[model samples]
Target: MNQWLLYGVLALLPLAALSGFLMGRKHRKGKQDNRLSSDYIKGLNYLLNEQPDKAVDTFIDLLKVDTDTVETHLALGNLFRKRGEVDRSIRLHQNLIARPQLSSRDRNSALFQLGLDYNAVGMYDRSEKLFKELLSDPVHKNESLVQLLNIHQLTRDWDDATKIAEELQSSLGVEQSKPIAHFYCELAAQKRQDGDIKAALSNVKKALTINPDSVRASLLQGDIHLQQKSYKQAIKSYQRILQQDIAFLPEALPNIAEAYSNIKDNSGYRSFLNKSLDAGAGVSVLVELSKIIQAEKDDRAAAELIGNFLKERPSLKGLQRLITLHIEHAQDSAKPSLQLLDDIVEKLISKKPRYACHNCGFETKAIYWQCPSCKEWSSVKPIKGIEGE
Candidate 1:
């Protein structure tokens, strides 16, 4: 039922009772209020015939302005709003608010409905004010807070979003930590763009405090430390991601390696890569390890390692790397044969996606923390197995 219709029905209850009483009195006096009864029956007939427009007109004409009918008017207004008839909803709610017979609670209800109508029509400023008014009322506090939060989020008002999230958590036991952390991260990004590193760092810390498992927060922290030349701190932050969620290891690898290089700790980097490879982390770790081995050992050793690993867990990327290594070390007599092998492996690897969304099976060459297809967070990851790393 439409909110306006429901309000109208509720308002009609008292009028209905009065009409019945008057009819009874008329019957005792051998008289009848035939006009009022006829109009009521006509309005009901229109409603039963599914002619809502005619029913509304008849009901409005027949129904007297009273506390009982106020609720019916609100219900009808809400129904119109639900049907995407915002103009009608707005008029009905506005009419209810103008009535002096409405109680304080009913008046607020009407205002809230009007606010929703305004919001539906994209009159955000007006909706914001009405929602704010409802927020001040204890009875509607939770709903008002929720609406306010949505408004702030739509407006990109992160500060207000954060505050309202906190309030909702405290008052309604709603878990807002993840979204709150994201909001803080958004603020941090804005601050960073404005060259306010200190403020950005503060927001990042706040994000971490709210949700310790936030990968984006850790990534941002590592990036800030890296920019400031605090390699050890950067390494620590990036390494934390491995424990937090190993699926993000690929994202952390390059930064981790850069930090280790800054600190002149090639041995530590090698050890980490070896451990990751041993644990069957992903093809990325295997590739990174192969690169390290190629630098420290010979092409033959790196090729052997990749070949042996591929035999156990075959991957197109591993095969491609192996072919490339062989091509690099091949004698002039074997050069043509090695080049053919390389071309075959390259074609195979090129046909596969580099990244995929775990949530939606969306494939792309680029990585997205949030899946563009499904709009889910931290779902897209490097494609694994035979064709990808």
Candidate 2:
């Protein structure tokens, strides 16, 4: 649960306690002043005197575990945890679990809540142990697996995360293929960084097997092959991405063109660029094609093509390209002014984010398969607009 939701629960705790007290008013009160024990009064006094530690202890002692008060206590414990009072939540939940009169269901609930409290406090080992213990209970099996998966992800324990996610999928029928693929891709990336190319490829293959259309897997496969100087194989792997998602064509285009250049396949690269542009890929295709025109044809031809493209769809990147082409071809008398314009455009383009999260609107210069802000897979993509595309 998010801190905001916990704040609401905390706000409602007093009301929940009041309601519970009112509902259980006639039950074993024995005229004990609405069940506010002497210890509770003492705890309130300690709190008023600014002795929080003593107050917390006295309050815990004053809490009488009963059927009617269970929800109230749980709400308050959760509230404290959300308010960053994790120690209090821990003590409350722990004390509630230690009660011999608690029903089996309430006991399990307390355990789960306590696990969440531990997680909130960065006691991951304790949280993981509690969640693992919950796997035997059908009531919290899915939730426990999910929390364990979260903990493994936070620790970058991709192997453990994959195993827990697989169990979650099989046991709870939750959709996990996307994250599972990402986990394999993460493993592949780690192996690649460790200079274990073969192991990296093995993990990439596993990612594709789990999610055949995973763009990140294909990109990683192409990248590794390119790094190994397998230019033709790399081009083939990158070309396969067109069948998956066209939004990522720009991601593979530059690498594929570079691989083709290594193999002296300029015509093939140019031809593929034309095909992709004709299929309405993005401004990246237009920019690459314009570069080819400037090199093989002339600056005027390239400028004309880009100017016409801009007329149809004005883009910050395309305008920058146009300005750069002008600066390259300008006469000596006009060179300084055109170069200044190009610098301004470059600065503008650099300041604008190239990628953004569709889920959370988080913008950044680089691409991410999962949104860092929202932790959602396939939600961050290349920004599409006049400034980005």
Candidate 3:
């Protein structure tokens, strides 16, 4: 709800009560002498003028904190949280929690809200305990479990996260395969980094079993295979990523090429890139193919390949690479001009973003499986266009 509208409603509550109180006095005593606080009067005027921003704070300050004003207090605390004033929200909810007279429902509501406040401020341990406490109440259980999952994820407590995800799936009937798969993948990455290859591959297999389309799981499996010099398995794993999501095909290119070359199968790599290009992967595929052509054929052949691809896609990176190749092999008389153009294109390509979030339009120089700003999973992908691939 709009803050102003919420404030406007809060402003009306006291006014409505006061107005009824005055009318009762008039009916009983027949006088126009009923009094209200000056702040209350000013706040009512502000609300009448649609300036509830000024009215809400002024009115809530003058109102006594009691059962009568609990709703207003909660609304104000929510507003504070929305505005990122987490400390203020925490204090308000804590005060509400301390009120012995509060009903059971209201107390639980305040406790749940305070848990969120703690979560917002990076007190994951506190929030985790608080959410665990709320898990017995059906009203707060699902949301608290979700919050606990987020906290576990933030803390990299994969064991705890896996347990909660499975429980949520069974008890709450919530589908958790994606998150469960990611949790296993996270475990795989950690184990792989620790050189526990057996455990890492085991986790990778579990992730893939849970979510067959998990690109991260496939990528991890491919990386593990490549590290083990299992070229055929690595190539198969990398190829699976293209089937899972072609948007991430670029991420697999370098590893796939290396695996092919490790096995003396450059032609296979070349064939894969061409097939991917025919299916519309992007400029990275073209660039890699051109590099392969240059290695196998000549500078002129590579340049012509890039030239044709750029003619269709018109990428600054592709153009820059083409110019770099020319400058590398250009005649001495023409080197300086080509060098200037290459430098210009290089700067332009450097300034361009290489990845963007499909959900939020957040741009970045590098790919991210989870968007930093939006916290969305698998939303940031390698950008596709002339300037990106």
Instruction: Give TM-scores for every candidate, taking all chains together and pairing residue i with residue i.
Output: 0.71, 0.88, 0.79
Which is the leading candidate under TM-score?
Answer: 2
Tens-digit lDDT track of model 2 for 1-389: 46654554454445434643543564555545545555555655654555556755655555568887788789878877877889889989998999999999899999999999989988899999999999999999999999999999998899999999999999989899999999999999999999999999999999999998899999999999999999988987887777777678898887988899999989999998888877767788889999899899999999998999899888888998898888866799999988888889889988999888988899999998888899998888887879877
Question: With candidate 1 superimposed using the best TM-score fit, by how many Å does residue 63's alpha carbon deviate from the native?
Answer: 6.3
> By the TM-score metric, which is better: model 2 or model 3?
2
Q: What are the lDDT scores of the predictions, listed in order?
A: 0.80, 0.85, 0.83
TM-score of model number 2: 0.88
> What are the per-residue Cα lDDT tens digits for candidate 3 across 54-83?
665565555445666677678768877888
Q: Candidate 1: list runs displaced more than 4 Å.
A: 1-75, 278-280, 303-389
lDDT for model 1, on a 0 to 1 scale?
Answer: 0.80
Q: After superposition, which runs of candidate 2 have C-alpha atoms over 4 Å from their true positions?
A: 1-37, 47-56, 331-334
Candidate 2 lDDT for residue 254: 73
Q: Backbone clash tally for model 3?
A: 1
Indicate whether candidate 1 or candidate 3 has the larger lDDT: 3
